[model samples]
Target: MERAGIDGFVYQGPVRVSPIGTHALYEGQARFIQLQFLSFALEDAPNLAGWRQKGMLDGEYGEAFDAFLEITGAVPSEIDDPAVALFMLILDIAINPSRGFPIQIESFENFLIDVDAGIRFVRLCQAARDEKQVLSLITEYSFTQYAEAADILTSSCGYDHPLAVIEHIVEWQEHSPVAKLMEEKRGFTYDLSNIVVRVMSSHFLAFCDDKLSRPEFFCWPGAWMTGARASQDITNLFLKHLSLFTDKADDDGIFPRAIPGVSEENAVKTLTAFYANVINYDLVRQWILSDGPFNYEFGWLTSKHSKEDMTNSTKQAFQHAFGASPDSFTYTWAEVK
Candidate 1:
């Protein structure tokens, strides 16, 4: 605002999640908060950075940046493997994208499995819990389902819709009211408090729903020894602990398990539903190839694995999607043109 020769506005911290929740619980919360942050940034850059400086945005750097590094409890420098790259992509989508196509959390969960990086995921979850920031603990099974929580925040929380709200700020920036005021008078008071409130509310509501509501137990200290192989494994362990601790489901049965005497038909039905989703991804795939702006990059990121694993795992993913044995696979990441 100084560039516009105006001043006065409020701001809030990145906020935090507690570290005491169950492993499954805190991870869900962390994912949700990350989504809210990403959605807000993608929706509007200028409102936060000011219209005059819309051309640039600051990276999380300096003392605040170092503090974030320290706060994470796991050093950013420690993530130096293929799994780290994938984690970075996931975070990139969560924190930096303009607007990633809506996707399921399991897509992320599965990718962690594909890369053999379940432990890192659990460790992050544990860290959040240790910080006492996770406000909810619900375990959402799919990304689509998790997005439902986002919808609740947009509807119930007083903040503007993440994308639409940001868009409005950008629209206003075209003829920034804050700028016009300064031109008309020697000094003007800009009530950018609205912007600050909206952003804070979005962050607050996301943390509440994802972290505070349904806390879970994470084996942070023993995550390595436990050796859980996938997100699902970590998730199951948390659920099992809950079952043992609570002795039967919560009153509402939010986390339901099968009845022993029931026929296996229900299990088959569940598998069928999953298969339908995999099949439907073909439509999303077609959309990317034909209309997606980042088609080439998407293809490469989705297809490439590490050089250590010569058979690109993404190609194997395609084969598995088609019911073909994933024993062998290969694909080139040549330029899309």
Candidate 2:
């Protein structure tokens, strides 16, 4: 349900059934979903002021990576690689906050969902001569199958095995010949866009399929949500809206009749309006100013910013991994002399 993360990586959501029934005549959205894992994690430390005169390969930060793995354990295991672990530990700190456990997240910001197509489809339905025709108009554009995006993984990413991208990154960073190959391939070609995403998505899924199935975990897709969660609680909100617009085969609500009744005219009209407004949120710039905290689905997204206390944590991880501070990798504030 979330899009990009703090590292600026893209996230493709799990396909879910779109209410209004799978589009019968037209193509419907893909509704199947799989949880995903991204390649990096980062946190920032701004309070310590300084600049490094030289890289210290012998520093404590080098071992910090291992310490992290020892704690989280076995398989959110992508961190098993020293290079990835080090990179994640050293990168710029996270500006937005949220839980980062490979499969859990509760907050995010600046997401944008494009609704132009959805809006157009709604209008077409609204213009239908009658309820039945309205259905046809909407179907011409999309199947009732939950609204899959234009870039479904199977169609966009395909089954080809991905290159050993992580290894390649390590090689490139180490001044190996791989860097030249990547530059040449980039050749400023727009078509090469998202090539990394395809590679990582495939890699992540394969990892999850083979590894992350322990009974102790319940996983889902998306990244550190500053506040909003990835849970049935969220899903239920979606379903609530869906039920308002569409009907089910069985009558489960206590009433024999829909409270307002007749999904044909009024309900369909209301749906058209709802479809037009579901844009993604931008928590920072677009957040509505409120007086004090409110309690509800996304009410926790109130804005706040502060640097993390990564002091010993980062170096400790490096120490645990490499048995040293990884001196050259970490910088200290200009010594007070």
Candidate 3:
């Protein structure tokens, strides 16, 4: 909760190295993400380490977690790798904290369900894998506390690839989350689709990036989403943009601007500042300077507006960019008006 020295941009000593400094000091999308994560979590690294240490020693936890939430501005349902990593870290610290972190907290946003669903599903999948020989979903993992996840896995996905199973759910299961979202939001695009895309793609990409994963991980996935091959810088920009930054609260291309407990004032001060530091990293910055004012097929920019408006907007944006320098880049957008 201390100010000044804890800030990521100005933080001296170890925190500033590699976007995330080492305990003392310190390439792939994984590498970039690892560094970027340090930027967000580095400020609280000491607090987290202390919390985990104290929690492990005293068996009481979570008084510091609420403040950590305020400091990190982590929303539980956020599936971005950084937030997910932070969530994983905190989970390890607070799993059995005397009162339990979320359970101890009075707010619903901190509820364990948001983070637990994936854990439950994975455990269920493991159960079903072992159950393949026994032909029953009643393994110790499934029976422990994830009977429902077990049921969903067995009833819907079986023991096949998670991506294939998820796609099957979206495509074939009429009442599935995506299916229902599609039916209800007939003409308009929702952030739900993007969330679905992001979650699945992150899983696939992380799997591919992982060196220790199963041997079969090398096989191509069967997912039908639109995606492009991007270098780590491009991937970092896209991920950081989509995850932490956005155009405007009113933009229909994104979800309603809401990060549960984060106030608009703090959102701007905290999240906006966080995003600025993100793009300023040399690798990410150089790429943006060279090839930014980017457009993707279904990105938020092209997701809205007619072809004429889009074309005009692009022309205007590039016209402004043409005269700009590496120094011209800032957190603010160039006026295209």
Candidate 4:
């Protein structure tokens, strides 16, 4: 496939591990599970089956499923087990799929099921949230204890909260000890890689639920970069990254290590260079930077420079902000675009 020019990080297989926990790794795993559950649950539903059959699950569906497997190494049976139902609840609320798979909860009975299971899962989510707020789990809490809670939440019937439950969870996380620790620690001690994994997982969930769009993936790369501004700087970094490559090149050929961070001049230079290498970058750039579905994926980040609409200039601007090079590497345009 690489030789054939079909490489662009396409989704692969199933979960290899269990999908429940308070650790950052678990957070990533849960998000993957939720994304897959959302995609498959909706795709498999009786009502939405027809629409899904038309190909809604064809493009990124595998990505979500593969994401689940990558994060949580559970087999297909484990993923589908009734004991793992809480995974469904979190996906339904946080990664609610409306288009390919819509939520049809109209009765108290279904709501009860969700509420019962979600409560526990939400608690685990709360614990994890607190740890994130504090910016350190290994340093502060017992990983075993946190994992135990996560297991209970992931496998039991406590994940039944509506969207409102998320608010409470957030509130709890905010007031929790972990939050204080994170605030106090600030930039002194932070595991950015873990943070990136968590954010990517969350964003991936949002994308699966149709809340987030394709372009938002760019911000994730930036979030993974070093520096405080990486957190605040959101200039549609993904587009610039994508545009940097020519459609005629290999996947790994894109994204050079020497690429600088996003900046004004660098952004324009990168955009011009991408256009020079791959004309299709223009089209993909538009789809990514457009003003559609970003908030659905990026929840809180949209408020700051985080939440933003698409723009024709976004490709250049993003590259400028990141200081990327256009000729760094190459990949076929159709693979990722």
Candidate 5:
């Protein structure tokens, strides 16, 4: 069992029977008894305590606690582990309130036990609780919210779904002070500015590349225009270069422009100059690969499009601007003129 990565324990003992049980029975009977137990030990078990402690200190555990309160609508004192408390709360929400017996909850608990997740399932539950919007979406949109909740809990812990993260970030921004300020100043009453900022800051090249490669994915060309209206130097830089990767507007040379902002002529010239400098200095690839908050935005694009296609489009964009693919381009930051 040790060779097979199984831990086991054995027990042996002698058995004794009552002599009065049968008149013909032997006075004493000798019997061999054996038992074996098997289980797997946790790796780095001590670290979990420290991790939980740190989470508590850093407010992650508190956030989970608040989410637990929201989901279960219960006071914090009633629950031992916030994660398990949340899980039970979700079960209550999923099950019919009129039912007297919680058979479904019992069966689900048994299922967790069978999968050996019973001991540490709280961690997974905590992750699901962190993404409150996803939970709410599942509740409203899914007929089987219980199963969906389980799947979300498991996936949140195991996978890095970039798009979902982006959505969460964008949604959070929509309700933020920045978004409200932009709305009041620009007369745009939506999250378009935040989405633009998020995309530019996090995934600009990948986003444009995806839009260029798959026109269908370019459902919101106007969003890019809205980004242009941000009037920031970095945003202008993105729009100028992005045009080289996208289709030129119609005969009037008119591109989608946001209302009450920089004039069309200035926008074009600024973007043109920005594009020129980037291409001239071989900065196209660097901009895409630079270490920044938005560097991995392309990862989010892959949720809806093929990674290969996104890569190819990015390579193509670089080639269009720099006359060479990213891999073949020899310019390094130190070597740049």
Candidate 6:
């Protein structure tokens, strides 16, 4: 009869908590409930124990189930008994580190029913389209809520992971009405190069100087390039857009206009350093200084430049423009690629 902590419930007798009630529980409590239910189900349901003995609940699947719970906050108590039982089976075939679990027809119908219920609950609780509300939704486990959070971040905050989330949503809900609507509205084709370009352009215009707080602009391109399902279109688009910043050079040397909270010199240097790190020095030099268009038709540039070369180039660029690197200027990019 443990207290449910933030959910303000105590397990009484042999009665199980409803999925709706489980949803109200805090993460740790929810995890406890899931484990408790799983253990009970395993003892009562011989099929589950048989499946577990058959390597269906191996360490890998167990770890993935843990992660799934972490991300989606799903509790066994929240899903139908049949669905929960089926999920253990699906976990054996699903749950890869890189590619994620593919939707298996055997369990997905019940999974979707649970997902829809979570979505309705989240939507009902949503107060507004502000950052707080959006973040809360994103932190939820339901597919629709995750997608909606990504969309809100993209449209309102100019955050860039929405594309990845949308891709996942499309895969999971390929035949759903919502998925169809998203495909029609967002053109959820595998080709995301054009969308990346447009979104990056808008993000640069909107939040270039605010990169300290929202470094997603810098990291996102690399993320897309690394994870892009298509070809080199993403890489090409990134180089092309980065070239635009190079084109912003003035007598002051690459002074991006209208960026706030920093001098033009610092902004240029930070951005240049970021580009050097992501694209390599040879490509940066070619795209920034060369008069020709970047030949992204090919993959990474053939010209070999060491990390030292890129670092020195960045320092030289800063020194030439600002006489010295700014002592306190600090900007970082996520290691997405």
Best-fitting candidate, scored by lDDT: 6
What would the per-residue lDDT of candidate 3 be over residues 84-165, giving only the tens digit for each residue?
Answer: 3332222222221211321233423323322233333333333434434222222222122122332334444222233333
* Over 4 Å off, model 2: 1-234, 237-309, 328-337
On residues 184-290, what C-alpha lDDT tens digit does candidate 4 reach at each position? 22222323323423333333333333212222222122212323323333344433333222322333223322234434444344433433333334434544675
Top-down lDDT ranking: 6, 5, 4, 3, 1, 2
Task: Please provide TM-scores, in order, for all candidate models, with all chains considered together.
Answer: 0.21, 0.15, 0.20, 0.20, 0.21, 0.21
Alpha-carbon shift of residue 98 in model 4 (angstroms): 19
lDDT tens string, model 5, 1-337? 2243322211332222211221111111100000000001223322323433544313332333343445434343311233332344332222212112212233332332222221223344456557654434332211243345544654665522223332334443355663554333233222323333432333333343333332211221222223222236435444534432233333322233443454555444434443333333444454566642212124332244565765666566657755866667344454447
Alpha carbon lDDT of residue 135, candidate 2?
Answer: 20
Off by over 4 Å in 3: 1-135, 138-256, 282-337
Kindly provide the TM-score of model 6 when superposed on the true structure, using C-alpha atoms. Answer: 0.21
Q: What value does the lDDT take at residue 124 in candidate 4?
A: 39
Model 4 ranges off by over 4 Å:
1-159, 172-250, 253-337
* CA lDDT scores, all candidates in order: 0.31, 0.25, 0.33, 0.33, 0.35, 0.35
Expressed as tens digits, the lDDT of each residue in 1-337 for candidate 1 is 2243221211442322322223333343343333323433454422322421432222221222222234444333221222222222222112312222222233332232222222223343333335332213213222332233333332332212234423433343246553453332221122233332332333333322333222221211122112232356456444433321111332421122342332345433433333334433554475446443211122321223343342344334455556553333233356777
What is residue 335's positional error in candidate 4, in angstroms?
45
| Candidate achieving higher TM-score, 5 or 6 | 5
TM value for model 5 = 0.21
On a 0 to 100 scale, what is the lDDT of residue 1 in model 2? 24
Off by over 4 Å in 1: 1-262, 287-337
Candidate 3, TM-score vs. the true structure? Answer: 0.20
Better model by lDDT: candidate 4 vs candidate 6: 6
For model 6, give the 10-residue run with minimal summed lDDT. 89-98
Q: At residue 280, give the lDDT of candidate 4.
A: 34
Which 10 consecutive residues of model 5 have the lowest summed lDDT? Answer: 30-39
